[model samples]
Target chain A: MLGDCRDWHDVSVIEVQELTKTFGTVRAVDGVSFTARPGEVTGFLGPNGAGKTTTLRMMLGLVAPTSGRALINGRRYVDLERPVVEVGAALEATGFNPGRSARDHLRVACTAAGLPTRRADEALETTGLKEAADRRVLGFSLGMRQRLALAEAILGEPRVLILDEPANGLDPAGIRWLRDFLRHLADIGCTVLVSSHVLAEVEQVADHVVIVARGRVLRDAPLAELVRGGELKVGTRQPEQLRRALEEAGATVRFEDDRLWVSGVDAEQVGRAALDAGAVLTELVEERSGLEHVFLELTRAEMGEAG
Target chain B: MIRLIQAELLKIRSTRMWLGMLGLSVGFALMGLVFYIALAGVEMDGREALPPVTDPDTVRAFYANASGGVLFMMILGIVGITGEYRHGTITQAFLVTPRRGRVLAAKLVSYFLFGLAFGLVTVLATVAVALPALAIRGGSTSLLDNDVPMILGGTVLAMGLYALVGLGLGALIRNQIAAILVAIGWVQLVEAIVTVALPQVGQWLPAGAVRAITRTTGGFGGMGELDTLPPWGGTLVLVGYGLVFAVIAMVTAVRRDIG
Candidate 1:
């Protein structure tokens, strides 16, 4: 995507340059590059083994990169004088002692950043964990734990937040709450980079998307741009007949299973063509491309090209 | 660095395991007193006991022998560090601090302080409980009168070093069982055999160095075969061992990818 060369007018919260991580002979994170900016939630989309976690870890300086660099707020994470104040991350919800109280856990994080201890209680309140604040984390449900982790991340009021699978264990209500919460954080001009396997959730929350597969970035663009790149699907019952008509009418046509897939023509045009050709239109549904379909297509296309 | 240390201390205080370990430390200390009382009784009767101890040095040696109960302290140390890895809490810690070395330093400091405190409390409790019985048998003696600072300092040093070792093992292996196995095996088996088979070389091993520094050496009985090093030399070696392992652990942790 040449993300590095493209000058993003907005403030860039995170920037990666040819980020590569090789574990022995395995290239866990290949030459992947992307930038996430403030006032927007950037979705780091990747399937399992796609190196999303590795990239995030590298960004946080938890894992060193074999090549390239990850810069946060125009400086390397390790170089930051106050890291917690600069960047707050929740890489995994399991990153807490189960026997410790949620309040104590967050208080420790606050102390690490030199923040006031009262921020721990405030974070718990923000994450709706005030009732369970004093309770041991061992008894928390997955959703509660996720919230607690989020609470810890925001305790510092950091300029940037990096979370991996933040919605993994949330219920529908919890997911909605998180979506709104992240959007509000971005609204207040905080940069948020969230990695998730759930395409739907990402689509719901992210303004920008970075799709990755097999240690490579397949696409890095605005959500609208990605959705607009794919051809829209228009369905009709006149299979063979419609294929011939579409080609005659200057539309690209392909056959899949028992249906005719038409491109290069609007859904209305196709319907008009079928009507003009005396074909009974049993079905005429215009399918807008979704992030899921775009993601699958890009990943599958990358796999096919690689193979 | 101070902030990280404070945070780690808070985590330690909030854990049930810490409270449990405190309880265990008290229990072991009381047990040490009971054993000391029994030994005093045998000494009063002038009966030829196992190993035949009758002097105050021997009595101090006997009480020193009971310090082996500090294994509970070791367990506490293991849980203190390894628990984070097991529960995946270390990621949050790293995310907050990012400076892996600083995070480790905080853990080492916090764990050492906790171990020191526990060791002091236990030693005082044991002396308090066992004094009456020792007095009846004419064996009671104050710690201050009998190199108490040396003894207490040695005990605290041993406990603190073991705790640091626990933290290192936790970071190196990351698995609770593996860390515990390595810790127990390092103290009970590997170090023991090496100290016996290679007395000169054994002086450098952590546990051996701890014994040497502590000065009261009848606990292992025949296993205390190696001539002890000077107390300062032993302390230096123990501290050096802790730094080496702690540095390795921190470096490895910061470099490795989290799951």
Candidate 2:
């Protein structure tokens, strides 16, 4: 590899700093920063309009940032002599010519990067598109198109792959194949940045996660750190009163509708508090914090704050 | 640069649009032959009814008149570039080659080569069909004449420029239908009306200049005592259009988001 992969403790393949993009008065990507290290799949988690695509576009030099910078291999994407060989990207699935065969599509990419034509055929086979390599893309399903896009991305065996919503329109088998393929790419020292609104799918593949909301980064941490604590939901007739009691007892209490959400407190403590307060507890359950729940909780809190 | 050009050529070769355009070029050449035969038949029946057809210059004029169908080939050249934008393939193209300037350059070179080859073939086929009809009508004309070379050169140049213009339009609009409409309306309808109704102003317009240099007398009949720019000058004007539009397209392509 041209870049450091063994020295993962020091190598940061991509470093985005305070990136911002504005469309008129609305900021699409506002002051977002994150780093993707070598040999890891970093999930760019965000909602539909949370600026994931804009940030990825800025990173790839497709859309220039209004402020700050995104560097790949310690250099801007445009500054790289061989962009396709340095950072392969598949922004959207339909970004292909329906009239072109899959092999020809990869051939164009390889030619652009000054790679050997053999790489195109190799990538087609790797992506499981060899059987359909000669078929025109017009007849391809969305899943097939996604595979073709992936094949194009990996044509030059780029060190870094930036894919936006790569799992969209894929069957279970295709998704599993994608997960395994991306993991395999990472295993070979490639830095993968996969963006999607689907948290569970990304959580399955990404080693690290960066959550963005309202054009800003809310959290960036390893997957283990993100899904560390178990969340306990306690529903009571007097949720406000229950929240105060939990806070007084030195517990982190969050109130939502008629439910009292208590983190840093176990279900037993919640039951004990309900018994002590002589309150009838209709519901008390300890729930695991999956990526989806974390995403919803983080984005919902950000939305409430904005409102 | 060579690799990029090869990639672009490969892309064009793999598309059905290229095949369709080739077929259309041959069809236009056949139409030219039909026109030449019909004109020759009419001329043999009554020589005094139409313009004089005596000298080699008159024979060249006859070929030019019959080969007017070749103008459609130029339209096909324009569509070639715009078709990619309309089909949403430019995204894949740019992703493959992030250097926007180099990609545009490759497109221009590829389109120019294609237009040149197609234009040459169409002209050759038209002459092959038209020369026999001219000989039957007692008119002496050789396809290898000096005037024929100049005419073919000018037509090829015109086709190349039009293709570039279409490329520029495709980049600016990013929609196939809109680009085609603008190209067709400007080249065929708008220029036809303007050159006839307003000769002085239309001479400076891009399509008018191209038509003026390519066709001889009686092309724009309403432009009385037509004073037009030289063929090279018209070519320069078309090239200028291509460059300006291409630059705009390049900037927009780099600046805008892919969505």
Best by DockQ: 1
Best by lDDT: 1
lDDT of 2 at A21: 94
**Per-residue alpha-carbon lDDT of candidate 2 for residues A1-307, written as tens digits (9 for 90 to 100):** 6443467745899999999998999998999999998889999999999999999989988787899999998999878877787888887887777888889888877776688989989988998999999999999999999998888888777889999999999999999999999999888878999999988788888999999999999999999778767578788876766777777777898777678778877777787777777778888877754677788999999999999
Rate residue B32 of model 2 by lDDT: 51
Q: Name the regions of candidate 1 deviating beyond 4 angstroms.
A: A1-9, A229-261, A265-282, B41-47, B50-54, B194-204, B219-226, B230-233, B243-259
- Candidate 1: share of reference interface contacts reproduced: 0.88
Q: List the residue pairs that clash in candidate 1.
A: A95-B88, A95-B89, A96-B89
CA RMSD (A), model 2: 4.7
Question: Candidate 1 deviates by what RMSD?
Answer: 4.2
What is candidate 2's TM-score against the reference?
0.86
Report fnat for all candidates as fractions from 0 to 1.
0.88, 0.68
lDDT of each: 0.77, 0.76
